[model samples]
Target: MEFDPALFIDLFARTFTFWWVILPAIFLGLIVGAIPGFSAANTIIILLPMTLAMDPEVGLIFMVALYASSRMGAGIPAILVNIPGTAGAAATPLDGYPMTKQGRGQQALAISFVSSVFGGLLATIITLLAMPWLSQVAFYLHSVEMIVIMLFGISLIATIAARDTLKGLIAGFFGLMIGYIGADVVYETPRGTFGFLELYDKVPLIPALVGLFAVSEAFFVIEGESILSKRGKEAMQKAGWAATIEGVKIALSKWWHIIWTSMIGLVIGVVPGAGAAIAAFVAYQQSRAFSKTPELYGTGHVEGLIAPESANNGVTSGTLVPLLVIGIPGGATAAIMLVVLQYHGVTMGPDLFMESPELAYGPFAAMAVTYFIMIFTILPLARYMSRITVVSTIYMSPIIISFTLVGAFVPRQYMFDMYLALVFGVIGYVARKTGYHTAAILIGVILGPLLETYFLRALKMSEGDIMVIFSKDLANVLWVGLVISLCIPYAMQRWRAWKAAA
Candidate 1:
């Protein structure tokens, strides 16, 4: 019942003692993060069982380190190749690629790394401080309110659809429909499984994530001899330690920039459903609006690069707040972490801290140590990392596909998963070729069941009255917030257009 300084000290001491575990994960993350399409979530899913096998502390530390660096690694391709490794890094290229074109590719990479470390570190501390206050939020948000929160995340699908709401919504709903494949929770009747026993359970997440993100991306990666642009090749040749040092100076000098943008990431990350992609874009937009030199933003600016990188990594910490404090995963990566925790029999939420302090606090502590390791590890390798773009895709593609396909078979050890992965890969490839958003579909598959489960629980408690969603006071408040958020943007856009016409 009392705060024991020794326990807190022991947790960090234990984490620090696991240097062997933390260091490898950071580098592993860097490798995957640099390659477009190899998201950390899929990688973790592929290797989920291995993590499950390790001691809980070691397993969690490994995942935390990889997840954090994965966000950092994505910035590499965005700056060098004009292609973001993960959608979270999508905002990085707005200014990063221009810097690369200006022969400042290494500098951009350095700034990205510094911003990420600073944001991740600061957000981790903030999360540690805020955990107690934030945990109380879970008490008020029961199933009814949680359903609204799920909708809030689903709403982000439209924004990521990239000017194609119809396609995004279709993808989201389709994933949701697929989520109902297993037998209904209330009754024993299978909802959508044509006949297979596999359908009697549920769709395996690992195969679905790998097939859609990793395998589909490999198909695209092979189309090129190299992943780099001609100019990117030139930039890589000249990068070295000096350039990385300069980046550290640039990022550290703008301490306020990193702090504020990272806070933006923290706020959005806490909200259910909003991931780094939204956080990065929001931070970028805010930075531009408040800039004294807004005109310089899209033209290879350090501040521009800093904002998004900081925010996305800040999101890394923010996502965990909900998962640890409320048992709700805020995004896909957080969901993967949830699976690992559940597999290991670690219950989340406030009580987790009291019951399993080591498990509850270990992830945050590991995050801090990881950032410490990342700064030194990634900085020296800026030169080496930049050169990766030059590696021919001929070599890279097969390695990526073969490894990921293997990963698809890891979770359940079922051949059905391999087939399922290929099917999702084809679907992902089609979605990529068309305008449909892969994230929307993935989110649908991941969160659809969660949403349905909560909705049904709320309805059942209220004797099947759909209006139960608005019965609770917190639910009413959430509904109001959701409606305003959905309507205000369209209304504001129309108002601006009308004024211009007048």
Candidate 2:
């Protein structure tokens, strides 16, 4: 666990020599990430044969670059078109799309890119230095502690519901009901599926995501000439590279926000099955909870965008920690990396660090390098990418539906998923028209099942004792933190109101 400046410096320089491999992968990752239903994990799987053909070091660097860049790419569409390329980017469009509607798409993209790169780079460095201790996070966070952590994310629903408690609660509970559609984990009986075989397994996330965000948004856009307002169109047309510069400045100004939010992702990523989605949501909730201007969150606040983008990208480094230190893959992407490493006859775990320190630490070093390269590579494209907003919705709506429908199909390749997406699309449109928050519903859909799984596991361990949640000291501490986090915004709001009255 001792930090070795010389060793890391050497690895960093060596990774730079693979810029040829890294550069192309970065571009490919952006494309893969921006497209709905595609992810670095599946894309890597599709290209496994090609990856396996390369040397282990080259392969790891390639995957690292692709993984980091893809995290950034998922934000681009989320910012411009209100389509989250992946679940991790789900919290992104809450603010990013609003910025686009106001003709600040270029600035938003710039902020997202900068926050992602720096946030990821910082986490990668921290992971390298603290890998020995950070790996222990997985072992310490048992089912009880994770339940509390899950609450941290699920609390976001209540936060979103703050403006109109009843409608938000209705939307959130509705999504939770939908999430429970599959067979109960403890028993084999289906809960809400209406006799469909596919429903017995579970409602697939990709179709649900694209349907609610992409397809639903596509439906609304057709009611206008463009996704932008008249003033927004004029501002966008007049925008130059200055907007990109403004974004970078904005992100840099919020350096403290990036640091803490990304740390949230790093800690969560160490726990197995706690993917970027949870990290992003928790970070956004915490950001809003602690902000002085909490009301500005969904209305295109820069911090709102930064919090999720930073946290999600920070997950890139944290996922590698358990993979290298404990022979456990933190996520699907890390699992694929494990296969490649095993193929190359490299054993993981602590021994790998001692026997082959280069391989053990090389990927993190490569990640740091990849993030450094990404800002320069993708930052210039924000100006051009933002222009998509000015396109006529007549053409754009069909294009979005076509691509999203295809994205819905790619994940499971079930014809049923496409139909399911349209169903959710109509549902989303109805909710939007009824003044309900789709993001609140989404938080429920994503976290409800996870909460149930952990809660059931805790209960099973405790012989169905409900108080088992309070059995762990770590769990108790997390509960206290969660309570404080949830209370702070309301307390702050009341304080401001009292001051105004005085």
Candidate 3:
């Protein structure tokens, strides 16, 4: 449990010796993450044969670098084109797209890249310091507590209500119902599938996400010659290397915000069932709550862009915690790491460090080395990547629609998923035309099932008692925190109004 400064210092130095092995994986991750359908998990799965062939240390280094870098890459499309390359980057478009719309795309990209590196590096430090005891955090919150955490994320809808709370709530609840379309967990009873065989299973999220953000945005973009207007075009042309330097300056100024928001991702990610989506939303909500200019949030604030992006990468390290220390993978990506490590003859659990310190600490070393490599590799691309905004929508639209639809089908390989994506694209278009908040709806879609599953499990454990959620001290504390977080924003708004009147 003791922190060994010299030991970690040596490990850090040793990881850089593999820079030749690490660099190619970083570029691979950047490409995989930038493409809408290609997830790190899927890439890892596809490369399993090659990975298995490598020495375990080489394999883990390649996978870890890819995993960390991919988290940063997902933000690029979200900022420039309003398409989230990964589910975790869903929140990125809220402000990142807006920044792009205003010709700040290069800065947004820089901010995103820097924040991701900061978050991932800080999370590695946190993991190093707390890995001995923090893995137990998964046990502190049960299904009941997770339900509250889910609520904390969904409550972001209120913060993003824009001009109309009614429309936002409607959009959010509608997405929540859509999330429930699959068969019920308790019984095998189907709910809203309407007799489609595909509906018997859950609606696949990749297609839904692709349809909702990428496809729908493309549809709207096609209404004009370009995705940007004259002013936005002017901004895009103005994007340059200076913009990249400005972005680093902005990120450095908000260093504290990046640190704290990333810590939120780390803490939430340590819980077995929580992942980047939850961490990003919660960080965004908290960022808005504490902001002096909270009203500027959804309208393309830098804080808004950094909060979610920082949290997104912070999750990379926290995800490794439960896997290495507790033998529980937090999500599918972690599960792949777990499988690969196990296949390579690495053991998990408390004594892992004792049995094989090299294997135990190899991932952290890879991640730390990855952040160093990503800075040099990705930061310079901001100027070039930002230029995508100037491309004619006529060309961009068809490509986005075609490729994302392909991405949608990649996960399940069903023609039905392609159809489902078209359906959601129509729905997303309607939501966009209305005063409704699409981000609100998307977050709901992401969190709704987790909320329902956990709630159901908690109830079943309590023999259907409604009060089971508040039974534990930890759960009670979360209940109180959720209530306060839900109320304070409204209370602050009212206080400001009253002060203005006085």
Tens-digit per-residue lDDT, 1-502, candidate 1: 2356788688888889999988988988987776654678877887887998998778889999999999999888678755566668767877887787666777888889899999999998788777776545445667888788677655655443334656766887887788767887777788778787876777776677666666776687677666555766676677667888888899999999999999999877887665787688668867875789866876888888999999999999888888988889988888988988888888887788889888887888899999988898888777666665566778867776777677667556788888887898898889878977666776677666778789888889999999898888877887887677557556857998999999
Which one wins by TM-score: 1 or 3?
Answer: 3
Could you give candidate 3's per-residue lDDT for residues 1-502 as a string of tens digits?
A: 4677887888888889999889998999988898877898999999999998988888889999999988888999999999988888988988999888888889999999999999889988889888877788887778988887777666666455435655766777777888888888888788888899887777778888888888889998888887676898887787668899999999989999999999999988888767887788788878987899988987879999999999989988889888988799988888998898899888888788777776777788889889988898889989988888889997999999999999988877899999988998998898888767777777777777788899899999999998998788877887788677667667877998999999
For each candidate, the alpha-carbon lDDT, in order, equals 0.78, 0.88, 0.85
Q: Show pairs that collide, candidate 1.
A: none
**TM-score of model 3 vs. true structure:** 0.96
lDDT value, residue 346 of candidate 3? 85
For model 2, the superposed segments whose C-alpha errors exceed 4 Å read 184-189, 480-502
Candidate 2 vs candidate 3: which has greater TM-score? 3
> Which runs in model 1 stand beyond 4 Å of their true positions?
1-21, 28-112, 221-225, 233-363, 393-396, 488-502
Per-residue lDDT of candidate 2, residues 140-184 (tens digit): 888898888777656565565336655766787777778878987
Clashing pairs in 3: none
Judge candidate 1 at residue 189 and give its lDDT.
80
**Structure candidate 2, residue pairs in collision:** none
lDDT of 1: 0.78
CA RMSD for every model?
5.6, 2.1, 1.8
Q: What's each prediction's clash count? A: 0, 0, 0
